[model samples]
Target: MTDPSVVHAPAPAPDRIGRLGAGVRGLMQHAEEAAGLAQRPGLLQGLDPRAKVAGAFALILAAVATRSLLVLLALFVLATALAAASQISPARLARQVWIVVLGFTGMIALPALILVPGTPVLSLPFGLAITEQGLRAAAFLTGRSETTATLALALVLTTPWPQVLKALRCLGVPRAAVMILGMTHRYIFVLADLALDLFEARRSRLVGRLSPAEARRLATGIAGALFERALALSSEVHLAMIARGWRGEVHLIDDFRFRPRDGGALVLAAAILAGTVWAGSVWP
Candidate 1:
């Protein structure tokens, strides 16, 4: 009784390896998309990475220093608008970073919502009460966290990873820390590729279903194999670096120069920061 014009969806893959492969691929796709977006002609994409880095950190510090909800909300809105101007979808940007911001903030702020002494706003079943002061404190804390995260995410999304690290070094970050960050970023992709290849190879050889014990055995095997592979790869990478005459220090070609446009950007950043600080003083 199936209609010839209608098509049915394929059955879901039953193997956990297959699902894991799909998940890895999805993550890789998102990373690639974000990198691609960085290359696109946009407001922040054209700016100097060093300026962007300084400006982003400046805004984040201001957000953390202030307790005024209005200032925090304004900063969040400013970040959203900047994303839009950069041709990045605000909703998509929020999706990528909001979980980290909201989830962590909620966990830390939730205690404040009931524990702090203030006028009772709501009475709960277990003799717990939400106070107005507690609610206000929670809102302020949450807003600050979200605003800081938003600004940080926007900077990362708009700048290339290499440029970001380089900018960090230019901004006086420790060479060891920058080197570690560079290697970590590089190895993340290497590990992801290794994982996807192994998972796909297993998936291709897998039959319809694996027994529970068989699946567990395969999972253990994959984990051990990947660990071994990582160690081997790290050794090879270190050897190659040494072969290239790498010393204890890393050097990147410094191309960042503070131009007139960058100066203008810095002025704007300072103005925003001043406003935020002043708002905190006036409001508090």
Candidate 2:
């Protein structure tokens, strides 16, 4: 008989820089989003994730349906307002959009689309002559891409993580996805805390620069630690489930209801969408 724990478990990182970098970035983004914010909801947090999601989609659809710069401009303003009301810091919100801004900026730069697909000019000191058509296409593409991204960020900022997950479950989102989210959301912080602790301990113990072998060993140790922690959590959860009631089918608690807020939320979303679309039509 094989040791089930050792056989099936993922191996720890061997001082893996790539995996560690990814983990650290994700950890920082979450910490930055929630840190130093008020404990209670300001106003937007009171709104349901579904409501926020709906509003975001409406904004996106309106922008997508119309190529007018006016519609895209409306989406930009609406998205910024919603993000502000979420109570997260401007820095954090900027972090969310950092990638979008960078990517779009690069795409619009003179050297990108101006250069033909097959042609490569080694020396164009002044840079390629970007055509008017290419510039317009780039602008249009950037606007559409940014509209969707802003919607996603707004939904994330305004909607509490658990409520977002719950809303997804309520909306008949796949059980597998819900389960993964449920488990990950609950334990992500725990893993982050553990990683931080381990890192601090290792740094404190370090003397001189480590050898290549030592670095690999340390990387592997971190991965091993994460794997064990996750597996232990899974076992604990499984045991608790068995203790209460053994069943293959999972159940979601019935907590959501059609309150007056729901209607009000939808009305506000409709009004914003309608007003934006109407305004787009009139803008010369």
Candidate 3:
């Protein structure tokens, strides 16, 4: 009973967790999408990637320098508010990250909230004592993680991958790991482009109507094709690498002149962080 046009036209790709919100899975998706988005022009996008790195560092520094619950809360609120203000898609972003947060993180967080060292033996369902310190500790840990994660996302969203990865290298990340990251990122697109071409070719041809068996066939066929192509690509890459004198090290070009926007990004980041923390102190 499907419409002829609906069955014929290609469906759009599903929105990934990056397109939704910022939970654990969403955070990962957000990281991926934000990397692509960082290339686009946005209010925060034009600043030097270095500035974004510095700002992210500063936010984390600010978070560590304070132990106040109000300060922590301020960080959380600022992160959430800024995310919304960015006009980024919320529901999509939330779907990407929060599910993992809810499932795995909440698993640990929920119980810790109900039990801890030296908690008052309050009457509860499972004879658990909810201590004030326990609550504070859990909130502080979770809030710090959440705030830091958001601030990191802001940096990643604003900064390009090359600058960030390079910065990571300068910050003492192991060379091999960084090199691996470099290679993997370079190849992901090569792989994805291949997949996209195949998908397009399929769509170009008049494909069958969606049936249970057909859907399974489509998925399996796509997977098998990808696997075969991947093997071919690996062999070709190996030959190419052997032909070219590609040593273990891969160099990246990163030489952008600092602009006034870089200075502004740092100042704005500092001002926001300072204000957020100060506001928390006054509120608490």
Candidate 4:
């Protein structure tokens, strides 16, 4: 005799659960790696975040101002050297910075190769031709993007998030902007963890593989629930922060001092920028 009270549920799908687990673990591992990198006793890591932020900005400006491909290449090399000095692996930079910048910039530059007018370098079907001017323009665009991204990534990887935010505040960025950036950064991780929890709970409760329509509905529901939870969490967090007397100002245990090394780094960055500008002007 079958028990009327008993309910049968289908077995859970292994693949879906495995993918969710892997994605969450990968994200957490990446965050941990970034934190570890910032703590390393490397050249950039030792310098004050203020100096690093300034230097990175100067380098990025140099990249943007330079028209010569050679100058951009030089900046990219300098960025790579700085990354090496900061104990950041080339593979990590390639995976995190280079690949992303190149992929995005490449798509934008591809159309320019056929659209811009100049001496024809290559002919293609559909009355398309790659021109010298177009090729140069595309190279310039892609190289500049890659150089700037490298410099920015180096700064981010070497500096802790809190210190970076504090450095921005010290550099005369508006207090409101700094506060927003800090809160956003902190909340991102908090929300990520919350999302992971939600996914896990859903996975546990899931009985079997969902049909395409069922999957879409489930995803939509999850998204709506996540948004609602995030709103409530933000409110509670704001109240808790107020209770703890957190004003709009950011504070850290170690106050930044402009050491001699930081001064030297700033000087070096200025010299590099000057040299790059000169090279760009003289390049035929």
Candidate 5:
């Protein structure tokens, strides 16, 4: 006896819950991909973690110390080459590192074009002008940011997190600092998974889209519940660690060995850093 002419409304989309779950899943996938990259038979992956860490540090220092745009470009090219040798896809680099850094740095550099006082390159309305000095400054800033990020990302992608932590410890980093970093990295995934589960449960229980007030209340309640659960989990983890006789030290199965290739890599990095400094000082 239902009327055939009656119109029906579409269901409301679970925008907030869906987006949160998707973001969490994306993070989890990114972490897994990074771990898989570390296991690949690539140039940086084959080197000792300590050597890789040192080399990355040297390259970063070179990037920071150089004032020449050409030098920064060279460093960026070198980083890209290293990434390729390490089996990283150019599209991945463009998507993850280059585009992100360029976008962020571009925003910061945009104002410099009109603010810097020099020979005017282009004139804008309201007596504003883009100067050669400003253009150079912006390019230098953007190039330096991009180069540094590329080098850092290359290191992170090719080295396992545990090995990187061990390398840091071996390189005279404070024990407490390393411990804190290790704990933070470990628990991030745990918290993400818990959040995803909570989101899923909430989504399943909902009959329709939440009102503004209802959504606020739900978010507040979820935040409180997550905080409580995180604290409880931390306590349980600490107690378990203590019960297992952990005395503020991390042990890994893979002991580091400095092979010939590792030594050569370190020396090459040092040489490049030295050359970059010399070139930067002498370049007009």
Candidate 6:
């Protein structure tokens, strides 16, 4: 016996600080979810970290070097297949990459569809015409961007952060650089937690909508507190590490070994990279 005329009132709009805080929280949650995916049994999970890193880098390079649309399409297909094998949802991958890649690149490429000179596909207003060349160029650019993006995300999706840093070190990256990268990643999560706490505290105390001035003042306070907190946390972390007999270097029990499978994976990646280069060269 529900009343047909019943309606719910709209929720009040969040102020700028609230919106920003929500964004921060969402990013933290999303990153944590992505990290969780690495623990799942998937295609790339058991491979040597070095092999995955090498293969992903090779694919990305091939994608960037190719100008042929067909070759680019092939790279995209390869990336998609890898994602599927790794138990990644195709729809989620597309949602994460396309929205950002296409949002900015699409805006840049849209003009080329009309401005680049070639065989006219369609005449437009102001004497501009859509050209076959422009369309092809735009498609190639977008395909390259998307394919590379997919591979990069796939790398993160497949590998844990520590292993990724280890792979980087094995790849001849400077130890200092690797350490900096690791610290940066860890600190990002720390700061995210801090932001979430600040936001939650503010939210709990908030009884009404904030005036613009109040919102601005609160945002400034939050930023200042975050900066101070970061310094304190960093010092505490360093001291704790020292207390635990930790050196400045990272140590992992899993030493990278190029097993037979790792070699096989590298060979397969090389073959695909060769095919991409050959196709792009012959076609273009």
Alpha-carbon RMSD to native, per candidate = 2.9, 11.7, 7.5, 5.9, 2.8, 2.7
Q: Candidate 1: worst 10 consecutive residues by lDDT?
A: 246-255
Itemize residue pairs with steric clashes in candidate 2.
12-223, 12-224, 13-219, 13-220, 13-223, 14-220, 15-219, 15-220
Please report how far candidate 4 places residue 25 from its true position, in Å.
3.0
Per-residue alpha-carbon lDDT of candidate 4 for residues 173-252, written as tens digits (9 for 90 to 100): 99999989988988888877887887888888987677768876876787799899999999999999989998777799
Q: Give, for candidate 5, the lowest lDDT window spanning 10 residues.
A: 11-20
lDDT of each: 0.85, 0.65, 0.65, 0.88, 0.91, 0.88
Candidate that would win on lDDT: 5
In candidate 6, the residue pairs with backbone N, CA or C atoms under 3 Å apart (3 or more residues apart, or in different chains) clash, namely none
The sequence of per-residue lDDT tens digits that candidate 1 reaches over residues 53-119 is 9898888888888768888888888888888889888688668777778888899999998999999
* Superposed Cα deviation of residue 179, candidate 1 (Å): 0.5
lDDT of 5 by residue, 133-182 (tens): 99998998898888889888999999988889889989999989988988
By TM-score, the best candidate is: 5
List candidate 2 stretches off by more than 4 Å: 1-41, 99-101, 104-112, 115-128, 208-217, 228-261, 271-284
The Cα error of candidate 5 at residue 146, in Å, is: 1.1
- Alpha-carbon error at 203 in model 1, in Å? 1.6
Tens digits of lDDT, candidate 2, 91-110: 66566674657586655654
